[model samples]
Target: MGDENVDEIIKDFILLQDDIVIDRYSNGGANGELYFGERKLLSDRVALKFYYYNKDVSTHNEPLILKSIEHPNILKIYDAKIIHQQYAYFLTPEISGGDLKNFKDNNIVSFYDAINITQGILNGLSELHKNPNNLLHRDLKPKNILIDQETKTPYIADFGSVKFISNAENSVVASKSTQIYRPNESVVQNVYNRQSDIYQVGIIFFQLLGGKFPEAPFEWLDDRQKSKFLKISGSEFEKWQFIDSAIDNLIVKNKLLDYDSLPAYINNKVKAVIKTATNKDLNKRYFTCSEFIKDLFDLKKQNKDWRIDNQEIYANKENKKYYRISEDKKGYCLQVSKNQVNWTKDNKHDGTLESIISRIHKD
Candidate 1:
């Protein structure tokens, strides 16, 4: 409600070449009256999200951190401004496709569709994980993922609770935006780490596949682990470091339930990837987003239809990347590209199986 803050947002908006039109929408968000704006400072079509200035301003750093990250799957941040000292962000892409949460309640999303969504999120996180600056998305959920109707592309949005690898940079006494997303129920203390973000990804995958939090399914957990999972659903929110890890490890206890009850779309390969990432023990799980992406590619091949003799158009001369065309081979596959790129190429001479995995173990 301050004049200075109002001018800051107006100026930021006007500076935008797209020049967003400001208007508040009564629907959408459950928080204070949802607002809608076109031609946001963030992008040509994306809208601006503004929450009335409450006491917590830790979220004020969200736009700052988002602007620093760039990836095809991640939502693009255009600008950050204040409306009455309240933070507002502008994004580049229009999210008319709707969210995964919306699709679940209305109807069942095909298994293939679910895989694609999981793949996209994994790709985005893969890029973010490599960032040397140490970015951990503390709050990753269905509501924060914006979907595009035409491409069915999902962009990760909402950085209000993002944790920097190192910094008290965004925190202050007056109004930190920490409580909205940061939970106080965990035994481990909070610190940004790749395992932490991976856990959130598992939560996203679980929600999409199950259509809601599996609180009742996991109600058997002790009060501490149950409380942590119910809050943010991971040890990333742990109140203390050493103690939290032990508790999380004990909680996973490999009680993966009702895999058979899952829809046919819930293929075995995809299930393993999701299960490993979400496992309570960080040690046995994918350590980085990059690892998660790699495993996703491997899992994707399981359901793909590819032929060694006559593969489909897997490349364009202009694009450096290529794929092994598949419809459904009904089994496992190993796709080796023709071009210069290769991690396995170097590790395993030329295209020989010697460099790759050795023969199966007799045991």
Candidate 2:
């Protein structure tokens, strides 16, 4: 649990491979500690996830599960082994773009890009659900996803809570970090199924569309309540109080999707997909990953220009630049920024949405 213990354990693993050089510690989450390192012999950068030996079956099964599945959107594991007799560590290629949480907070994800990212996640999830895998990614939050720097592809990472559908009835020890993402059935009955995975992915979809994280007794606060909620944040105790007050003010019951929080530009069809996927009733929800993907893919076919509403940031994955286009009473305004904060006016198009979009692409 201490830093020294981790160092001591990793020292043994490093000795085993003379070329392995531990660069630095990346981060520690509810799952485990991640270290960035490189193999001098192979000239490759890698990530090492260190999990202390525990009774939890998933901790031990993670590496094997990752090894069993092969997909562009899934994290690939090179090796899994017990180290210093106390830790179970797995090696994976280091992803430079970091996780979705950081990316979401920093950049404004475009409409089409959000759909593409969600599709990638669902594609990876499908692999886990297929024949031999039959696995449910119980904890599928933004933090568990890694984004590729070059391609902007989202890779599903963190398999600590992954389990097969056969073990759906088994009680899962939900960490504080994952508790917010738990589906209704998982919370009430200590169960998780294919639908549970669907529920979490739906939440991610909602988030990518500029909606706030829907917390339990999930309902969006009124305009006045939101104004107050924004102002009340300081100490940890105050934060808890804010959360409690927000929950108490919820007039609607069992609302999984916050339709109001979603951008107005989002059509009913896309909203319907999110609603069905995150539906509280297991019967109404998507039964499998393929079912979810079908709806999303259908939407993709129907719409080519999927851009979010005005004033929202859009990151062009091709050039790796931040840009946004907004239509005011006067005309359409396009702004570009290096960092998402300060913007410089790029162009103004008095024409239609298509014309502005054309300027955006050209700029």
Candidate 3:
């Protein structure tokens, strides 16, 4: 639950949570924090985000991410509002227990953990990439990667990570690359291409293998082939060889050598998959999240983690849930949850794609 002024007959939108135990999890983002409640929400015991902003506006891209995505791997956005003049980014199945960074820091992950994240993140991004609308997640980091304790699955958190490409424009370029993202040649060229997302995935995969990067963190190049290996800062580069050797044994050579420091079961095949995925060359990498998923499949098949016994029976359809939100006559909206929709909550122009999608989610 939240301190919402909920005497609403004006909007069809449904709020995801009520006022109960909304507390900050992490000093989320630079200013935001992940909030969890004592009791489950109206839909399910969910997590909510009170995104901070520059001037009394919430900057978290929760609405953008929700607008374009709906998947098991993504933290579901349920509602977004300007309550008490501060932005509250509402989401369903509120994620707790921190992010992937904690898991990586504690080295609490196994091959199963890595594989599930690989699959979930890729599946979520693949859906976003394939979405007819061009939406890019510019910021993908361990901190933004959440895992629900109940399902124990990874959910890509925060929409402040979003970038949208415009079709009407002759030229459009996204903002500067973050320290965490590894830019491909095209992205480095400031081309605002789809490959930027691919580059982000590569960085995440690398972090998955070697933990965190230090100093300058990820490497960015105008060309991956031209730049095979560039100098990086901090203990990250120092540990590169150890990671290199670890990946080499697991991947390229297919040697099932177990690390004295690691569990017995984590061996060659898993390493190889992670290596190829985190490869420096963006072109040499899988272009979309769907293709990247193949690496996990290969790892699972070779290592036997994913199987009929482990996966759900493939059904032709997924359950459909819809909601509504009130926006300015012309603004965007995303279906955050079954009962709530984060309508670009702006009643600006007479219309926005989010408004259109709002209609669809309702239908």
TM per model? Answer: 0.57, 0.73, 0.56
Report, for every candidate in turn, its global Cα lDDT versus the true structure: 0.52, 0.73, 0.51
In model 2, where do residues sit more than 4 Å from their true spots?
1-8, 11-17, 54-58, 167-177, 214-252, 304-363
Candidate 2: 10-residue stretch with minimal lDDT: 247-256
For lDDT, the strongest prediction is: 2
Evaluate residue 337 in candidate 3 and report its C-alpha lDDT on the 0 to 100 scale. 40
Clashing pairs in 2: none
Q: Residue 9 of model 2: what lDDT?
A: 59
Taking the tens digit of each residue's C-alpha lDDT, what string does model 1 give over 234-269? Answer: 464443443344334443444433455453334566
lDDT of 3 by residue, 34-115 (tens): 4555553443455545554334343645665675577887777666565433444455565655577776675444445566
Compute the lDDT for candidate 2: 0.73
Higher lDDT: candidate 1 or 3? 1
In candidate 3, position 85 carries an lDDT of 38
Model 2 TM:
0.73
